[model samples]
Target: MSARLGPGRTARTVIGVVIGGLFAIPIIAMVEFTLRDGDGHSLAHWAALFDPENARQYAPIWLGLGNSLVLAVVAIGIVLLLLAPTMILITLRFPRLRRAFEFVVLLPISIPAIVLVVGLAPIYLVIGRTFGTGIWSLAFAYGITVLPYAYRAIQGSIDATDVRTLAEAARSLGAGWGAVLTRVLAPNLRPGLLAAALISVAVVLGEFTIASLLGRQNLQTALVVVSKQDTYAAIIVSLLALVFAFVLLVVIRLAGRTQGSAPRTARRAATAPSARAESPSDPSDPSRKGNNT
Candidate 1:
């Protein structure tokens, strides 16, 4: 068996390396491009980004980065606090409505960003007045844009999990809705929820047309604006953004895998006592038999 698996494992590892190289090559090229400086390569472009004199020129990028981060947080909030619960409720309570709800949730992805913005133009007029044009208000639009992606992630997880059974079991154990959600449902759904959140963040950060058309600043818009001026600086920022996203995804995966372990441990501990109590112990052993007598 080990011999059979050895070849398969090596094949898989080789495939993985090839795929990783395919992705890493472009990023490596981008890094090399930014390092170019006429006669020689150097970190001058990167270093200039932090230099005091050039600070104001990069201000828009900073502002846009901050806005994008805020939008990511708010968009994740919308997905978790609103979209996720609606999906869970549909799964557990309103199975019949699932198809219609899915259609509504997924409609945005089919529509182009420009068309969505055209439709949103009027609505944002009201929103602008009501919300005073804060960058965070973009979350409302972002929430819609990210819904399709987030929904797929969360729904996949929900489908894999027997959420109905878990909910019912928790309720039978006298857990309230809040308790059940926090203690039972949340732990099980953590993987899907984290994946959905990460997807939403990725979508928000990469977004350009919608933010550009909406006259809002975001990371992509800032990159475009910076690119026209200090091209190398723009590339550096793009490379850093890519690296940051990669790291963020790695950390989130690690967190999703490692978290909720304590609850599993506690559950095991709780069940162990019951198992020992229910089982008859060592009746065949001579010491046990003598003690009983």
Candidate 2:
């Protein structure tokens, strides 16, 4: 078995190394640029970002970062609140509408960002007139952009489980629609909900076109502004953003894995004693003979 597996393992190792190196190259370059200052290595640019005195100078970046963070939270909330219930309702009550719902969710993907921006401009103007152009309003558009991804993640989870039966069962037990959704369906779809939230947050963080065109400052726009003012600082910020996104993805994956494993662990714990009970007693064991006696 070892001999047979050797070549495959070696190939996989080599492939992994190559892929990691490929991803590392740009990051390595960014780090080197950020560290280089006047022929010597320094963290002055990075330090400038956090310097209290420099906060006034970096107002745009600070404001942009703050806006992005707020937008991410709002976007995630909107995505889950909008998609989760709609998806569940469709799955449970309007099964025939699934195809149409999916088509609508996916329509955003085919629409070009520039075109979408143009289409949304008039509505945004009306919104700005009504709500006064708070950057958080961008979350509505971001929510739309992330809708397809969120829908697919939740839909996949719904499809994998018997949501219809669960809802029906909950209803049969005198549970209201609200209770059935919150108490029964939500717990089962935790991983999918988490995945959707993470995906939406990531999308909002990295988004530029909508925020930029809509006259909003977000992380990506802030990075662009910082780039013009201080290239090294921008590079550091970009690298940090990349690292944060990677870490978020890793966390989502780990959470999903843990959620998936819990049931299996419980099943094993429940079955082990039963399996032992069903097994034939060993005649050679004095303890077994005594128990029988």
Candidate 3:
């Protein structure tokens, strides 16, 4: 068996390496350029990113990072909190309504982010004039903007679970709908939520046109502004942001794995005891005689 599989496995490994190299080449070039000097062997560009005058010029770096993270986190939270329950409710209680809701929710994906920003700019202006350009307003926009990704993630998770069975089991135990959702449905959705949050964060972090058009001085917009003055430092700042995003992704994956594993362990524990209790005793047991008699 090992001999027969060798050729196929070797081919797959080769293909995987080729694909990985293709993706890595650009990233390698970017890092090299950012770290390289004009003559090709220095870290001067990276060094300049830390200079006092440079630091003042790049003050937007920390602020933009914070703004981006805040936007991503808040958008993800709102999307999860709003979408999870809505998806569960629709799938459980009003499944037929999903078609209509999906059509509407998906409209944002088809609409260019720039167009959406253009349309929403007036509304945000009105809101800012009244309530100020607060975090909540931006979060709300980000949440709506992210619906295409978040909704699909949530909907896919709901599709994976035995929603009807879980709901019925919970109801049989005298649990309310709230209890059923909180206990039975939400716990099983950690992976999907993490996936959605990651995608949403990626979208919001890289978003340029919307922030530019809306006149929001968020990270991407700030990055553009910095790039105009210091091309090399801008590249370095972007590389740092990319590193931060990678770390965040790794953390999310680890958390998802830990959370995903716990329930399966508990399920096995519950099932093992029940299975042992339900096993047949000796055939000579008196319970058999009761039926015969």
Candidate 4:
């Protein structure tokens, strides 16, 4: 079996390398492009980004980045707290409404971003008047935009997990609904939640159309604004943002893996002591009886 699978494994590795190379080439090209200067390649453009003298030039990018971060946090909180709990409720209680719920959650994606902006523009105008035109208000639109991806991630986890059984068991133990949802169901859903959150952040950061049309600045919009004048610096910042997102993903993946393994490790520890205790007290064992005698 090992011999048979060797060729297949090699093919998969080859395919993965080719796919990865396709992505890495553009990034490599971008880096090389950013380093070009008057005489030779230099970090001059990159260094200029942090120069106190030129801070004003980069201020818009920084402000946009800060706004994007705020949007990410609020959007993530909205999705996880609101969408996650709602999913669990619908799954456990309103199972028949699954299709309708999915239709509503996923409707945003079918509409073009520009079209969504058209509808959102007026709503945000009202919101701005009421809430005073903060960039954070953009998060509501982001939350709606991210629902499709977030819902898909979380719904898959719910399906794979025995949420009904888990909730019932918790309730039988005298836990309230809130306790059952948070303490019992949420942990089982962490992988999905993390994945959904990552997707949300990525979508929000890369977003341009809605933010542009809405007259709000985000990371992508800032990059576009900077690119017109200092293309090299904008490219550098873009690369950095991509690296940040990639690193965040890897860190979350590691954290999720660690969290996943913890329960199995704990279960093993719990069982091991019992197995050892039971072995010696097995009266049917002649060796044990002889030793006691």
Whole-model lDDT, candidate 2? 0.74
Which segments of candidate 3 are over 4 A away from where they belong?
Answer: 1-24, 38-40, 50-54, 243-293
Q: For residues 1-293, write the lDDT of model 4, one tens digit per residue.
A: 67775668778799889999998999999999888878799988888988889999998899999999999999999999899999998999999998778678767756667888889999999999999989998999899877776775566557657889999999999999989988899888776677678867877887888899899999888999989989987998889988986776565455445544433322221121111123322233221111000
Model 1 deviation from the true structure expressed as Cα RMSD, one decimal place: 14.7
10-94, model 2: which lDDT tens digit per residue?
A: 7978998999999899889999888887899898878887899888877777788899989999988987787899998898889
Q: How good is model 2 by TM-score? A: 0.83
> Candidate 1: what lDDT?
0.75
Where does candidate 1 stray beyond 4 Å? 1-26, 248-293
lDDT of each: 0.75, 0.74, 0.67, 0.76
Candidate order (lDDT): 4, 1, 2, 3
For all predicted structures, in order, the TM-scores are 0.77, 0.83, 0.74, 0.80
Query: lDDT score, residue 67, model 4?
Result: 95
